[model samples]
Target: MKRWVLTVLFLAVTMSSGLRADSSDQAAAHEIIRAQMQAFQTDDANVAFAFASPELQTKFGSPAVFMDMVKSGYAPVYRPRAVEFRDWVDSPGGPEQQVFVIGPDGRGYIAHYMMERQPDGSWRISGCYLEPLGEESV
Candidate 1:
């Protein structure tokens, strides 16, 4: 009985400290990505740009410019037909979220999102790179 209680307590403590728990961060990132994608679908450049990190915002200078770049470059992520969140992994820069998406053109893509955690504990998308999946992949 004591061993079982201690085991449960150990797990609770570890999970609470985020030692083995990452759903909160992953879920928040997923929500942010979804909202940004929705904004893109609606052509709301301002709303979509708001989810970008300060670094990207500075690089683009304005939401219009950012939207233009996305429309021309990231077609898959700009208007995906379907999206599924995959793995969240730690990297040298930070945590990365991989999203599997079916593009507007019916092409499969994997979007790697580099997430930046702001000072206020909010996450922003620092960058996204869409890699086309092979014809055999889905």
Candidate 2:
């Protein structure tokens, strides 16, 4: 029947479009993380701060302050030697991106980045929790 054919066509298009959107989102999220990491490596706090959520930016007041906090509290993230992105998980707050990182001292860390979708539909880093990789896991 023509109706059945049209229904199937609509479903196919919708599913494909959804897939494309998800892939795009994933790419964008990964790019944000990469850019932020690059900024940190270069000591470009302003550039790095741009990738943060609005609330986070407000809380820090300035990029210098944010950078100071990162330097003191997230030393591994501030100077990660090896970085590998993992799965993106959905959370009630928004989405969380898992990143595997190796510090300069060669210790492994699992960084869970909480991402938020901005008003303009772009993603930003809301928060990050770094857990050291245990010997057994490594």
Candidate 3:
């Protein structure tokens, strides 16, 4: 019923009119993502859930529900064996951070993280699109 699942699961990431992120934005964005990943690693659902946008938070209702959905549908993001920051694109929606990930299954994938800049100037993940890059690590 919501667009986040469909956007991440079914559609391919094809962001256009994007510009590379400046160093400051890149650092901040990457830091938040890495922190979220660490939260997942430690099973801190509340910490991990905080990285999501307010809109997403409301959609899932609670940290537990958000974590469950991520564990099931976003395996790579939830438990990435390896994570590499690729491109930080400034799209119409916001800054779209593309990450290269090695999944728990040992497959390679690209995670397109749609970020939202809060009024306070912090960032949160609004949506994500995961695509299979290859069987081998990239």
lDDT of each: 0.92, 0.88, 0.87
Number of clashes recorded per candidate:
0, 0, 0
- Better lDDT candidate (2, 3): 2
Ranking by TM-score: 1, 3, 2
Residue 88 Cα positional deviation in candidate 3, in Å, after optimal superposition: 0.8
Q: Assess every candidate by TM-score.
A: 0.84, 0.81, 0.82
Q: Give lDDT tens digits, candidate 1, residues 1-138.
A: 999999999999986667347888999999999999999999999999999999999999999999999999999899888888988888788999999998888989999999999999999999999888975235
The residue-by-residue lDDT of candidate 3 on 7-105, one tens digit each, is: 865544333222332667778889999999999999999999999999999999999999999999999989999998998877788779999999999
**Index of the highest-lDDT prediction:** 1
lDDT tens per residue, model 2, 10-128: 99999777756687787888999999999999999999999999999999999999999998888778998788888777777768888888876688898899998889999999999
The predicted structure with the larger lDDT, 1 or 3, is: 1
Q: Over 4 Å off in model 1, which ranges?
A: 1-20, 136-138
lDDT computed for candidate 1? 0.92
As a TM-score, model 1 comes out at 0.84
RMSD of each: 4.7, 5.3, 10.8
**In candidate 1, which residue pairs get closer than 3 Å at backbone N, Cα or C atoms, i.e. clash?**
none
